[model samples]
Target: MLSVRSKAVASALVVFAATPVSFASAGGFGDLGLGNTDWQVGGFVFVAPKYEGAKEYEVRGAPFIAPTGLDNGTSRVQFRGPDDLRFRVLEFSGFEAGPLVGWRFDRDDNDAARLRGLGDVDGGVVAGGYVAYRGGPVTPFVSYHHQVSGDDTGGLIRFGAEARAPLASGIFVLATLGASYADDEYMDAYFSVTPGQSAASVAGLAVYDAEAGIKDVYFGLTTDVPLSDVWTLKLSGRYSRLVGDASDSPIVEDENQFFGGLGLSYRFNID
Candidate 1:
């Protein structure tokens, strides 16, 4: 086990080097000098919502990096996804825990005509932590996020379970299902329509107060096909259905949002 001081120093270093993927882009990798870590790096092209809750879509590209622990007793595997960067600082049994940081792209009225009066929410960093347990074929995880900079969109709590399995020779599928909960500030910043906003709305939107609650449920799937021993074809898609007040907001053109993209990446090893 690393001393508490040592762990904090290492975590801060990772926080400095890696930037979160944000609402528009997705993913990254590991810890430095952390023993024999199997590293994976690749580039990805993905289409995502230009802003959360917007019906519009845009094509985007991001890099991918994931690192796993060797099956050695001294290490444990870490996980990465399209929106956040996390590095395991503690592992015991099949459980690993770590600090997490993700980027949140802001919302601007120009994002969509429907947002003509909602104004702009600044984009900034979010800092949080996560815990996960891996066993059998499924891994369950939970994480919390709080805006550390930019507009005070407050905090979000997200929980989910993911599974990976082989679909065919040299091909595999990974899937994740999750839901998000938001604090009052987070719910209101993008969902609430203030009197001033209502008056300014070109669409004549009504004023609505979006309270803190369960905001949305989401699912994501990834299919990986090996093109060669060192290269792979990665296809991914995610769908999210806004619920609660987030769905009812006058600014929400569509309560359901989708994203899909495919990319080629070189693998470092068997994950």
Candidate 2:
């Protein structure tokens, strides 16, 4: 087992190795990286009062609770902001990279069951960096985000591709597909079954803890409706599947999530 010091050292090495790629592209906010050298930063706040089923999953066999499918409907209301610094690395190829920091305000039941140890995640800060390449239609990116200290105290390694296209009526669409691999500490803390619990007797199934290495595959599509050069309405829908030990856990019961959000994004330094 790697000691804490060893783990920290390994993580640091990974971060340094990947930081350069994020700046390999110079496009705009829509690209994988933050865009060209002209660094720009912004934040967004979103609310989903009507999307009750956004991230909810099914629950069964609760003594008196009537087994009402999904419980604790977490009305999606979250405020997240990212401080991004983009630097132009290659002018000929339009490449850029930078570091970004973000924070979120709510933790849903699944996130609680998976992110928080026992209850809701009040809020937490995530600090990391991204490296990306964008020279044509296909842009590939790799990013590392570690929650400094919060609901999710684990590190995530993600590699993905983004494709952008233009449609009629001045509408633009961006499609993304990505996968991630997470370590045990992050998994067990959120998806593990407790010792006292008897998953076999209760449901005739074996419950795996969060420590099991899990793989997640996700795909998303975002569209931009420009209301002028400075302002655009951005909306996106994303879907994810959790597999491996995390997927087999009793708490999750082989669950999946569909996420959708709408936000207004403003772009500065459009030259």
Candidate 3:
């Protein structure tokens, strides 16, 4: 027989051990799966900069719902974040692969007061797929998405790993590290500045045509604390560094960006 605290610790370990790790990329949720076949609902408040390089920060709220379990024959539906919604179409032998679709917010000059003349990047729907393998305490995954409708017509590819380790009573820590690659169209849309555009903007701003390459590398840490049988609290922090063409873009003010958030979730099991 296990005590309440012991049970809580065991449950936390199972959840982290069974799920795929995700990094904080556009339209990405760090940890998600049908593990334990339980439904979860939660909301979070986070502080993030307006754009990759901007100095201003904005506090925003997001809601999430995971409505499927990780049973062998069960399907999964999840809303991981504002820009990440996915459905698992296939599941077998510890492997889950599915279609992912989501919306991306436009980056307007107004997003950051200092970007008034940099122009706006239109938001649109992205469609893609993700394949993940969960074995023991290590999960490795890959995902790709293309801008199906928007001003940007490129795609993105991401690969990452997630690992978990128990710390103390009912507490666990999860860490994620990943890298992202962007296509030429996507890179140019966000990082490029045309000669005409440069002339219309501040001095020393050069016309740059960004080519496709590794855009950023990111890492994140999440602390999970089980409060009760059905409730859990999570605290997370992430840092991303712009690299290659993205880092060289004159419009970019800060090459590194940070984000932090906290959330509480409730789980409901359906039998």
Off by over 4 Å in 2: 1-96, 104-123, 196-207, 212-214, 227-232, 263-271
The C-alpha lDDT values of all candidates are: 0.66, 0.45, 0.64
Estimate candidate 1's alpha-carbon lDDT, on a 0 to 1 scale.
0.66
| Cα lDDT tens digits for candidate 3, 97-131 | 88887665567776654456778787677788888
Stretches of candidate 3 off by over 4 Å are 1-42, 62-86, 91-95, 168-172, 202-204, 229-231, 265-271
Evaluated against the true structure, the overall lDDT of model 3 is 0.64
Which stretches of model 1 miss by more than 4 angstroms?
Answer: 1-42, 62-82, 266-271
Using all chains and alpha carbons, the TM-scores for the candidates as numbered come to 0.77, 0.56, 0.73
> What is candidate 3's TM-score against the reference?
0.73
Point out the worst 10-residue segment of candidate 1 by lDDT.
19-28
Clashing pairs in 3: 22-30, 34-70, 37-69
Better of 2 and 3 by TM-score: 3
Ten contiguous residues with the weakest lDDT in model 3? 1-10
